[model samples]
Target: MTQIVILAAGMGSRLGRSLPKPLTELADGRTIMQQQFDNIRFAFGSNAQVTIVVGYKLEHIIEAFPEASFVYNEQYDQTNTSKSLMRALQASAPGGVLWMNGDVVFDPMALERAAALVAREQSFVSVNTAKVSDEEVKYTTTAEGYIKELSKAVVGGHGEAVGINYVSRDDKATLLRQLKRVGDQDYFERGIELAIEEDGLRFEPVDISDLYAVEIDFAEDLERANLFV
Candidate 1:
């Protein structure tokens, strides 16, 4: 079974809203997390385990997704995506896992490609080279196409990471181990960087540059994301 973990524990203070990021209504009238679930079901079918990590206003998410499994992150106020992701990863079933940021809205095709990669037992990070931004997490790959670095500071990098990735069954343990090295204040990608550099965890870049995707972190981002609808 392939598990899908969504990190949605953080309060969207940057968005300047009282609503939790995942529960924020998109232009389509559905919440961001609902769109994610719809896309995931389209790509991977209905059988895959979809687990969400919730904290701030967790009840809203529970109400929104009554049937979905959830892992509570009690330290959401004190931690970042890394900690929320660790909780989700720990709760995931034993097998390949697809990890996504709950506040992001991406084209179904992008997730379909990610699911295909995971079905092949490949661990990969989705990237969009078409649009690169300084504020978004970026990735740099070696000439051979293996990820070398992943961080927001990687200016002039190959592409922006789309906040979606897959960890094969064989690599799940290694990824969890690497995630343990990440600090509470850091993004989960930091653990991926460490895994790539220190443990040689192979996370190839899957270019989905042509696909439409947006991380709704701010008002401007929400405006741009509306274009997708």
Candidate 2:
């Protein structure tokens, strides 16, 4: 079974408000995290099990998703997603894990495809072959399709990370140890880069043409995510 881990710990200072990013209102009355969870559950089928890594107003998250198992990161404000992921891994049972940023909103098919891809390949990330946009966070890829470099700036690539990742059990241990070795990095992508360099844990690109997801960063993205609803 594929375990889904939703990372929702950030305080969303970029949103320019005191509100938690995940609880930001959408057009349909559901918060962004709730929308993400609903879509993931639908894609994973009724029997799907989920783990939510929460901080930055964890009480609200706990109250909102009473059924979800939670892993708290007290230093969420001081650390980055990579550290939150490492801590969450401690509580997680070993298996293939489909990890998504909680602030990302997408159609159910994207999550379904991610699960399918991980089950087939060792591990993969949902991405796109479209031309890079100014708003896109990009990565550099080798001819063999393994990620050679990653950057928030523009670069040559057939794909862009869509924030949905599938990690296999074998790669999980390797990646986690790499993250630990590179402790206290400001960004999770940094840990990913280290893992790729040190342990050869490359993220395969799974084209997300027929499916879509948007990572909510600013208020504009919060407005944009409502369109999918």
Candidate 3:
């Protein structure tokens, strides 16, 4: 069975909305998380085990998706993606977990591209090399094209990580261990970077540049995302 996770624990304070960011509605009238659910079910089937990590205004998410499995992040305000992702990993079954940030608006094909890696049990980070912004999480690859440096702090970055990734069942333990070592505010990318640095974990960057992926950080981002919808 395929395992999928949606990290929806952050407060999304920047969006300036009363509801969770994932609950924000788009032009098509589908909430962000609803569209995400449709995309996941479209690509992975109705049988895929989907677990959502919810925190800020979690009741909104829980009430919206009653069929999904959920894990609460009590420290959601205090921690970051690393901790939210770690919780999902710890609660997941024995297999690769395909995960994404809750606020990313993208084509369903993005998930399918990541699904290819999951089916092969290979770890990967979905990336868009077309535009690498300084504020986004960027990456630099090794000689083998596996990820070398991944974070917002990288200097000469190759591309932006589009917030979708998978960790093979084989590498789950190592990545989880590394996540525990990162600071509370670090993104999950930091853990992946550490895994590559300390454990030699190989992560392929699947190019999704042809697709639309806008992570809604501000109102302008939401506007850009709605353009694709």
| Predicted candidate 3 versus true structure: per-residue lDDT over 1-229, tens digit per residue | 8899999999999999999999999999999888898889889887798899999999999999999999998999999999999999999989889999999989998888777788899999999999888899999999988999999998889989999899999999999999999999999999999999999999999999999988999999999999988
- Lowest-sum lDDT 10-residue window in model 2: 149-158
**Candidate 1 or 3, higher TM-score?**
3
lDDT per residue, candidate 2, 194-226, as tens digits?
A: 778777887777778666677888778877777
Please provide, for model 1 over 1-229, each residue's C-alpha lDDT reduced to its tens digit, 9 standing for 90 to 100.
6689888888888988887998888889988998999998989888778888999999988898987899999999999888887788788777888889988988999988887788799999999999778888999987788999999988678889999988888888887887878888999999889888888888989998888889998889889888997
Provide the lowest-lDDT 10-residue window in model 3: 110-119
Pull out the clashing pairs in model 1: none
Candidate 3: segments with Cα more than 4 A from true spot: none
In the predicted model 2, the residue pairs found to clash are: none
Best by lDDT: 3
How would the candidate models be sorted by lDDT, starting from the highest? Answer: 3, 1, 2
- Note the residue pairs that clash in candidate 3: none
* Best model number under TM-score: 3
Worst 10 residues of 1 by lDDT: 85-94
